[model samples]
Target: MSKGKTDDVTGTDTTGHSWDGIEELNTPLPRWWLWTLYLCIIWGILYTIAYPAWPMVSGATKGVLGWSTRANVAAEITAHEGKNADLVAQLLATDMDVLPASADLNRYAVARGGAVFRANCSQCHGSGAAGAKGYPNLLDDDWLWGGDMAEIEYTVRHGIRNEQDDDARYSQMPAFGEMLEKDEITAVVEHVVSLSNADFDAQLAETGAVVYADNCAACHGEAGLGDRSQGAPNLADAIWLYGGDREALTETVKNARFGVMPAWGPRLTEADVRAVSAYVHSLGGGE
Candidate 1:
């Protein structure tokens, strides 16, 4: 209260300082607000005592409650495992091939497979399975290996181009140029192009038949249908490893092409591989 002056109209003591002749009031903190602040201070003290609050060289202080981040994480995992107990059991007991064809089960498996694919395959095949330049697209109906469910499962389990995988699918198409003469190679290229409905001189292909029998028939078959065991591709189909163009065919005969697919068995669990195989098979091509 102001010692020198008081407001006669209101009958209240005036504060000492005024701004532009207006008086100011000295207000006390509300009881509720003060209590809240006190409670916050108490909470801080209790929290410090109940949990690890001080940092040390190797670790932190183990407080009275013995709470720790590791303990919290383990607790969370335990809770998750409890909730998924049935799913885990079903996955383990049921054969992957015999899983029900019901929509609900299919949706669940695909979702699970999607997670596995992102974790393991997204590096080569994009998140949407839209493969890179050398890698084959899952969305397409073409597959270097057979696109059967069993085939896909086998490929994922054994892997391709995996050095450590003993049962991995292995094949190597040797360079034909090293064995065949230049004219013979040219004829074979012409014959190969002809199989795709590309224009070619009949005489050239006729001459090339001898070259095909001697050089390519062992792996590619006399009909050019290819052998899955050897990983040789069907030459008659429009699909070409390098390209379907004449130039591509010429280069192919000159030097046999070898494409690599990494094995996933070493990188992912068996369950994960099965899920991934199912997902890939469902990608518009599986029998």
Candidate 2:
């Protein structure tokens, strides 16, 4: 039963509803605001008709304009690829070994390779190529294989001891547990440990030296200098893929270490392979 009425105090129309002693005034919205709201409503309707809006079972409605965000993105990608096609072709043609001779190509490869490494190699080798346990640190001075760019490329292409790739770099260290007596294994562990650690038992090392000379010397070298030819690790240098401690050396000598790296050759484009190799070589460890 509320009706509009004029208030005596301000001479403004009252809404005829009051709480306590206060009355509400019938104030209209700004003209500009009302006009804007109407325009928005109209715009929304046109937008629904002109662009993808309503959803269906399989997809959204293709609006009258026949435009798609996905199509736009695909076109953009195609254009980008066209722009870089020549560069990519050049990269592919260039030998990874001599790619660095071209300053511009090297820079481009390194930049591209860094991105590739982050996406693919960073999981095992770390973002900085510092590596984790069981993974060889790419940033280190030592390498199980050669540390140069060409060697890195070969390793990346062929992989290490991977059954999937027949051309993989393959090496075997005999499980001394099967070959050597328990005392001999223990002594060999002591000798290998003494190669790196200063406080090893000299008597045990002397005993292990004979066993080492007989077995480990061929691959690991008499001076324990790792042979890159056989992928044997240098014990005397103290750098270890596993660890250089006595217990670590003991386990390695007894059990043996066989690590596998999946070949990138099959999956990645040649340019990508070279780029990632270049990036790895740029890491402090590379010769």
Best by lDDT: 2
Q: After the best TM-score superposition of candidate 1, give how far the Cα of residue 174 lies from its true spot, in angstroms.
A: 0.8
**Per-residue alpha-carbon lDDT of candidate 1 for residues 159-178, written as tens digits (9 for 90 to 100):** 77668788888888888889
Q: Report the C-alpha lDDT of model 2 over 1-287, residue by residue, as the tens digit.
A: 36889888788888877878678887778999999999999999999999999999999999999989999999997897688788778888898778778898888888989999999999998998998888999988898889888899999999999988988999998888898898999998899888888988999999999999999899989989989988998888877788877677788888998999999999798889988998898877888
Candidate 2, clashing residue pairs? none
Reference-based TM-score, model 2: 0.76
Deviating ranges (above 4 Å) for candidate 2:
1-75
Residue 34 local lDDT, model 1: 100
- lDDT for model 1: 0.77
lDDT of each candidate versus the true structure: 0.77, 0.89
TM-score of each: 0.69, 0.76
lDDT of 2 at 225: 91
